[model samples]
Target: MEQPKRLSRLKTTALPTSLSDHAAAFDRLHPQVQRWVRAQGWSQLREVQTRAITAIGGHRRDVLIAATTAAGKTEAAFLPLLGAAAARQDRGVAILYVAPLKALINDQHKRLEGLCADLEIGLTRWHGDAPQGPKTRLLKSPEGVVLITPESIEAMFVRRPASVEALFGRLDAIVIDELHAFLQGPRGLHLWSLLHRIDAISHSRARRIGLSATLGDKQHAAEWLAGEGPQPEIIAVDGGGAPLKLQVRAVVEPPETSPPTADLEARSALAEIARHAHEILRGKNNLFFAGSRANVEALADRLRTLSEDGGVPNEFFPHHGSLAKELREEVEARLKEDRLPTTAVATTTLELGIDIGSVHSVAQLGAPRSLASLRQRLGRSGRREGSAAIFRGYIREPYLAADADPLDRLHLPVAQSVAALHLLAERFVEPPSGDPALLSVTVHQLLSRIAERGAQRADQLYRAIGRDGPFAAIEPGDFADLLRGLGGGEEPMLEQAPDGSLMLGPLGERLTASRDFYANFKTDEEWRLVNQGRALGTLPIVNALAVGSILSFAGRRWRAVAIDDPAKVVEVVAHRAGRIPKFDRVSGEPIHDRLAGAIRDALVASDMPAYLDPVAAQLLAEGRDMFAALDLARTPLIAAGKDTHLMTWRGSVANGLFAVLLGSVGFECETFDVGVTLLGTPSDEAAHVLGALDGCPPIETLGRFVSNLAHEKYDDYIPEDLLRRFWVKRHAHLETDVADMIRRIALALS
Candidate 1:
């Protein structure tokens, strides 16, 4: 096979260096591509698009396109990439697009349908929901672009290892959408290993392109995208379109009457928030980001009820992971069509760019998770010219009774929201962080490689999945220990043959055969929820539900009719009222130290944010008053009743580590958002203990105090020593933040 003429030209041509040269880059595109762009009536390419064209069309170097949502990142990447694919001389998939969510793939498929059709480039979506015929057709004559998710790629390696090279041998470009989503987690590691494996299999020096809306550090993101390949050219477009219009509203919950009435008060507070959301967002195309699935259900139900009582069309709907795909799709379709006013009260499932069309505004129903998320969500709005990005933040603070905890008195939720807003205005976003030794994903890749190759030597496995692979943090000795644990145990996941080649043991074979082997993340065991024979998505089996129990789900109330334990099914019927059902899911991202410190600053500052409404302003004032009264700026440790609260003003991780240290020293303690609570310990005793600390404790010593070490799916299969190491590495910040926190506390006490 010979090199494509376009590629050969790109290799020799000097890349455009300025805006004046953008036209020359555009001219370098396929003639038909230029015609198509002209037909679209775009007078000029966006800065991101222009830069992408020069970088991608001119060279084989990896590229990262960082821009806000609705900035035409997809077009920027594809216009140049598809040009290369169109000019390819050989058959096979020329361009591979990977996304974090299946919804994103589906959205992109629709987005690129017309363009791909115009170019006569076959576009095939390979995911769980995609049809078999198209996949089979792609398998027979692999060509054009293939849109896929990481899990599906994992599945390909396991199920169709023989076809990997044939399908990807001639690939020219690999594009990763929502690049930030794959930067930190087991899923990211899994994708990284898969990419290396693919490279090893096909030996195709594919150019990587990453598209992201929110990247705190472009260099770090570029590093992640390129892996061990050449440094990627970074095309970062500053400024999201339009001015931001923001406001923070507070809903103060009634004081707790008693332990029994606390739940009712909580419901009342939520109802008040829902009322505020309904009044402000009714009859508009907006998104209300309720933080969790439970909040989504509760807020959506209340909004729907408010609509009913007011005799208006119920435009509010709940969108979460548990909702049925069709139901979620219907909501998405309604939003995209823009025929009716739609507001999706949703969780982070809607945080990604799935093309829900132009949102009038975004309502954050609780404290914003992070500045990055706030920026991303806000990007959905103000896409239309001359429209400002509108943001409404709703914060619920306690009534701050006499008996309220010191943390609650500080009004952390409201302060966090305000700090996040201030950071957003300053254009700050938190960088991604995670354990480098994501051994759990390593286990997954090891099993997958074994299944793919039938057998492998231990050294080869380490090189492929450990030393030269994604799990580069795993040392040789620790890796050997991990392998011994896997192969020497009674129920071994691996077995060594006489030739010293490792193959799957009985347990490993059984595991790899299951469909669940493809994903490295942990998913809850869920029960299929059905109402009148229609599948209403699934609910995690958090607890047992009786026949009479009414559950709030799918933006409606339902009465439990029957439970099928064997089938993992729950039958329900319409009901008048219900309580929000519990779902086994973590609520928010870990608060970074910068945000936490910002929150503290917000509390102590006298100047108020102009974005706060009357209620929010009052809450901030009260929090400031409390801050002054306690002199928390100077007094790091304060006695509140029997508990001594040590205000670390640090992120959750540091505070958690502090609490663990306290617990290890025979002082009962717990971690709140900003500090550690030494239960029943006097302030003096706590201060003395903290002041005497020289440095962070040893990892081994800290490991003795930690529990529930298994966080990942394959963690249970790992040996206790390795599992403990993984946990400590992921959770503890001993050398940096925790050490600083220790010294700070000691200094404050002294």
Candidate 2:
């Protein structure tokens, strides 16, 4: 193989020799790097590095470095690569670093820049935020290492073809950071396509290494990260990071004496949160990860009240995507400066690998959503010596009604999943599964191909996409339909050329050119509920539009003061909502099949423990007494408390189905959030809805129906109306499964 001439011809003595050789390389680290490590107390290299060095020394074809957060995976991936880069002698984006988040790339650049000084490894992060100078330099001379977000990488192939070819031609290895986040979205598909384009352009297959710990599913995750061609070896280190302390406590707000208003509950909860936060705030800086922007602002506002009353400086900060960059950055800076024992109430903006000061604890208002989330939140703490991630999850309730479902008793199951991830210190992690709806990625990649090789015959485009692209298995009929739609028409997002040279159609242009399209994060496009342009806080599209309608949000209420109808904005002056509307966060509930089954098994095996604090314990006892008196857990239908009905056997989704179907069965019924309610009188014939729902709604079932009434943003783009049916029908099986589970309980108890 002829190598590039800009050569060092240097020996990778560090890699070829044993760990001691690499250790020796580290010994001569730039004085600054050594001092920094020593200042943090000279500890031995982590296991991730120990194993990585051995693999890199052997010139291991590919490596996957899996370890817990704060376990030094970055050092593991880069330290060994320094040798290979030094040996290859030619520099041109010697390594292509890909991370799921641009912020992560920035964080990695800051942490790795000092170490690079010793080896003169030029490192830079390229993304929407990255300026043109370094990118231009990479184009002119692809020397050194470059870091980029998956989105930026996609843009590189499409917009900067020549630059990518030149820079990546001598690429030695591509490092994928935070590997899990990309394995299941349009972003992942785009990332894979980008890698394929690199191989096609450069011709020489580059070695690959992946860095992640909190990955939920590594087996599938590794394959996704590996791309389709040129398989890579996997290297995972049991991080052996510090232990985490996690606890979930339920917070029950007193039921409103009057109408349910959001502001009232928010204010009420805020007071309690302030008291608890005050005690915890006495320690290191903390982060409270809320599920939404409204929650962040409300939590921050309430916490500020505590400071005001305590005669202390304001320590509570707010962060989310909608906040102006300056405001968000200032909150981050204040925490970094240790200006006070501060805490920032934030949404997923703080979820990425952004580097803020180490904290003593993390608090979440509800479920952490995914195992990976639990791992990331816990990682925020324990960054310093003897520090541990202390998390307190609060689930506010309308006072556990007399007859809540047994499953309701199992709310902490999500917490259990989080605990399992934290057990990663013992070297265990779950890899997430690849999602099937990565069609958005396919569109992005296809457009990149069209841009590279200006128009293609319809058939050639099909072969390229189906035979070679990630959509290899897409049915021919569907593939043809898609092509016909794309050939030349008025595209809302894509601006088509007359001869079909597939320029970015209006919709395509908006989607591809904007930084937002690259984000696979399914955050709803929200607007700040501003009062005179000062954001009262942000609200979802649906909530913001429902102006003048009485609604509770952020535990506070205000008549939607005014609606910026054009901008889709709402401004609510804070008022009391005694009970807050539970935000319907759309992330899939991680239903561990095994754990759910285990819960059923546990239910039959022994008495389930009262997983409640002493106060809730008494309430739970009353709850159990109420259930026993009503026998609601075993019965399919029970008219229990005044307005409440119990249906313990049916899960939430199933109950929803049952309620909807019963309405069709001539029952004066409507679905309540938890159970079915009869508007007036209910007949026993309504029970027939259960069996009727078992079959499909009959393909041609009529009721002025329409196709593609989808909610998720990507749901529209893929144009998979039929497949959407499949997903609904498939998920409908959950109702069936719950029904069966209910039957078992009913029969066993009877």
Candidate 3:
């Protein structure tokens, strides 16, 4: 069905009367919609909303409502969508609400339910968590909006492919929420392919509307949201609710910890945080983002213990994927009402806008993985007029060297983090890079599509997907590699088929696509720690964990469980009472590489940055006195402290290169925070390291560390195959202009 024709002059009411006669239409909105808008306290329509209504509602284009969250984007997209559906479909779900998380769909469904309840249109949520009854009704009646998660929609795509044509025949639009979170990674790519396929089967065009909060680059995001460069109506939000109030502080416990000692472990930084959290989160509603789900569980237990000991009500709660959905949802709902005196210690699960009430404050337990996350957490605070983020940073103070960089100071990391947040909040991150790991996700999805379709012809399948689409850029070589992985020439698609026909095999089926095959996000490597016939969730199977050691698993301490190599399982019995710090990842992309350099420059400029924190003040004073005495900052090779110490502000990777280069010159070099310390002999070694490194000899002196590596996902897991791939790739761009960056550093230092 086509959109209703614009029979006469249509103009926005707000437009001046002289021009209104030719083009005003908004003032003519149905009386009920006008009333609804007024009651909702909307003063006027947003540009995105007006544009959507104009381009889509007025002309009926396959609209793409690409805008940020809390930008009234949901209403803008849906109001026109609902209007379009009202004109045509009275018998089926006209709108499909698909989001990555169930919480987002739930939030949208409820909001729409109130609006459409009396409009004779029904709303139905379909997901794994949804009851079978409503889904059955939607299948039977095929009316109203069917809110669903991507996985559930993927299931429907397989189980009811035939019904899809009928169910979504008049499908007006699809509203994808929290789009930025899923759209780039494997999950987004999978959804995109599924959507393209859904269009193929439905025989109806569904207007796509993607909603997100953090849109770093709107143009690129729009391109991804609308496949084949659909000329999506780009809707950059103008007036988001409010700006963020951010305050980052690092709490240092009494008694210094230079070299890690047993007593320091007992009195950990977490203890100091627990002390402050008791005061900071007393009256305010808060959400503390712990980077790991493991940390969520551990922090919950700690908070519970704190409440018990302090005789205060337990306001903190654990929230993540591991917790039962019912429990998690209930907690979330309660949090929204502001009646529940609770603070959720969560992973990124709670990061999206799920309307968990006007939180008075937000807390980050430790160094966050990215500046993007830090900004999101900070945004959660001061939702009302005058609230601020109670961000607290905690680091293991015990593990330190005699000469730790000022940046390692507890407060310095937080300060640098704040600076990074400022850069990100302004919407920049070295800009967005194209997905390098997209092939992995594509492989995952291809396997899933095959599983669902049962058996499909190679040519037909490839044509259906690759022709005139995002995969158009995908090469024949990569496709061949994927086909091979899917049990083809080298990798068998099915067990018996040497010809590599597309069939789901045991190997291909074990991937996530088998589980649902829809989600493309990377799964973490975990070792299920089991003890005494019970399951402990999982421990990160990193080189960070060693055998014969007692470490925290889940919330309790367990002795180095028997490391089952084949099973990749660790079996252990409870040991003493100690906990390992559960950190999911430590990724720092400060505003720029210059931040580290700027920090060093700041140290030299004045004592202000050094004396900012009490503990850092003493450390800085000692370092500065030493620096002046040795004249270390001025000279590359200085003997101010009675020995030759090389000071280079070339950053970590470069400093590491210097160390490797020193070895090339036959001089063993040790790296310190400020510079490199030459060991053994400096005369020949110093010349060798510099000659080997500066001359750009990949393997002349350093031998095989460059090409020895294959691939490594984890920092410590730099396998021989990985390490070669990483540094060669890591400094790939640097190879072009690094001479200048290095030369500048060398000249300045020299």
Q: Which of the numbered candidates is closest to the native, going by highest lDDT?
A: 1
Winner on TM-score (1 vs 3): 1
What local lDDT score does residue 333 receive in model 1, on the 0 to 100 scale?
Answer: 94
Model 3, span 1-750: residue lDDT tens: 432224212222333223342134356454455566677786577666666566655653345454443456787777666655655635667888887777777788878876676455778888777778978877877987888877777676666766777787767777787777764545666677878877776656777777766665555666677676345655554444465554444555445556868777446667666666766776667888876776778777777888899887878888988888888987798788888677888888778878775677677765443555655565566556444444554433333445533223323344344334445445553334433334444555566567667666666666766554456645565455456444533434444345645676665555533554554454555667788878877755422222333445455557654665435566777764334223211232222343444435544544333213454344445445554564546545543122234656444445555555444444434444335555434434443334334534553223342221211222221122323343344445544344554454456444
Roughly what TM-score does model 2 have, to 2 decimal places? 0.76
User: Using lDDT as the measure, what is the rank order of every candidate, best first?
Assistant: 1, 2, 3
Candidate 3: C-alpha lDDT: 0.57
Ranking by TM-score: 1, 2, 3
Model 3 root-mean-square deviation:
8.4
Residue range 113-138, candidate 1, lDDT tens digits: 88888889999999999999999999
What value of lDDT does candidate 1 attain over all alpha carbons?
Answer: 0.80
The lDDT per prediction is 0.80, 0.58, 0.57
CA RMSD per model (angstroms): 8.6, 8.5, 8.4
The regions of model 1 sitting more than 4 angstroms off are 1-19, 256-267, 524-588, 729-733
